[model samples]
Target: MMTFSPQLEQKFAKMLTAYPEGKKRSAVVPMLIYAQDEVGSITPELIDEVARRCEVTPLQVDEVVGYYSMLHRKPMGKFHVQVCTNISCLLVGGMELYEHACKKLGISHKQVTADGQISLEEVECMGACSWAPAVEINYDFHHHVTPEKLDQLIDGLRKAQ
Candidate 1:
């Protein structure tokens, strides 16, 4: 069985109304976003719930969740750190910066720290090649990062919180 808050049900209902009859599948993406926002990550149960509410199949919800990188399939830290390791970033010292972050945080790529404050992931082309060796913390991008600056950046986030 799946549980949903009244708010989520209402939001899902509104989203379903936006599509024509029998086209409720169109709301999968937004429903995934809403689910992720509520639960911090998308789970099989959540997908099933969304499917039920939207009158679609669970596989349909799964497809939308799998297609979007922004949709986290597993639990992530409060701050998701995505480092660019594409051609442009690699040409510049992205690898070194990534290594430094791993060393400092004591976690490898695609892993979250034990404290659950941060999760590190390597992504392709953050589209800031000109500012190579970049990382995105949540929604903010930090460019031209060096080993020393990485420490400062992490510390700054901690202090801000």
Candidate 2:
């Protein structure tokens, strides 16, 4: 049987009421976000609960979650670092930058560091060709990045925490 904690139930109830009855599907995205936020990653159980509460099929929730890169199906570090490796960035040494990040963080793409502080991901153009070799940490973009600059940024983030 699907079960949700009182808090989750309340939140889901509120989410349901936020939309009209027939448009409960509109809550899919927000529900996924809430589940991810609550559990740090979306699980099958959470998806099932979301589907049950939102009155949608599990496949519908799965489709939406899978379509978005921001929704992590598995565990990820507190900070997610996505490096752009598209055509423009590749021309300007994006590959080298990605390598440098892996070496510095001591983890491969789609892997989280041992310290659990950061996870690395490779993505297509971040729509910043003018500033090729850019990386997004969480949501902020660091553009026109060099190895040295990236090192500094990483250090700054570590220091900030």
lDDT of each: 0.84, 0.85
* Model 2 agreement with the true structure over 1-161: per-residue lDDT tens digits: 45556897688788888997688888888888867866778899888877877789999999888888778888787788888888999999999999999999999888998788788998887788998889998779989999899899888878876
| Clashes, model 1 | 0
TM-score of 1: 0.81
Prediction-by-prediction clash tally: 0, 0
lDDT of 1 by residue, 28-101 (tens): 88888877867879988888888887788888788788788888888888888888888999999998888888
| Best TM-score among the predictions, by candidate number | 1
Q: What is the lDDT of residue 58 in candidate 2?
A: 92
Q: Whose lDDT is greatest here?
A: 2
Collision pairs in model 2 = none
- Cα displacement (angstroms), candidate 2, residue 62, comes to 2.4
Query: Which ranges in model 2 have alpha carbons more than 4 Å from their true place?
Result: 1-21
Q: Indicate the residue-level lDDT of 93 in model 2.
A: 92
